[model samples]
Target: MTEKKLKVDLSVPFPTEREAQIACGTLSVDSEPKRGGVKKELVVKGNVLNIHFEALEARMMRVGMNSFFDHLNLVIETMEKFGPPEK
Candidate 1:
């Protein structure tokens, strides 16, 4: 079997840097402007094309693994409420 990478495209309608930042609450960490998909790997400035990688194991957390899962669920819930803002 091979490793497959999944890409998610966000359909936000913001066309300006300030609009993007205010709408999503993420500051631009880049010096130059950009548009479109980011690299497959993680980028310092998580944006429109950010990819989140999940590890199979949870080894470094103050709480137990179950607590981590619950925390993740809360994150998802927040995302759902925010409708996946570019960050």
Candidate 2:
């Protein structure tokens, strides 16, 4: 028999499984739900909280900053789109 595996697009990852205990959490990420993913233990170099949404972060960083206000606004927008700061 063959074991089917899931393709985990870590593009969006919850802080912990506890955060996924409800629908408003990571559960709402995708309706189909990502199942059968092989759990891999990782030794993070630094505090790796929500490292999956990197492309989104890069997109935010690409915005042109004409002044301090523009940069602040962009940062605020990014925080709103992404979650809170990692510990």
Among these predictions, the greatest TM-score belongs to 1
What tens digits encode model 2's per-residue C-alpha lDDT throughout 45-66? 2223222111122223222112
- Considering only N, C-alpha and C atoms within 3 Å, which residue pairs clash in candidate 1? none
| Number of the top lDDT candidate | 1
Model 1 residue 58 CA deviation (Å) reads: 13
* TM-scores for the candidates: 0.28, 0.25
Query: What does candidate 1's lDDT look like per residue over 1-87, in tens digits?
Result: 854444332233333443334433332222111232222122223223232323222332212323433543554466567664563
Report RMSD (Å) for each prediction in the order shown.
Answer: 11.7, 13.1
Question: Which portions of model 1 miss their true places by more than 4 Å?
Answer: 1-63
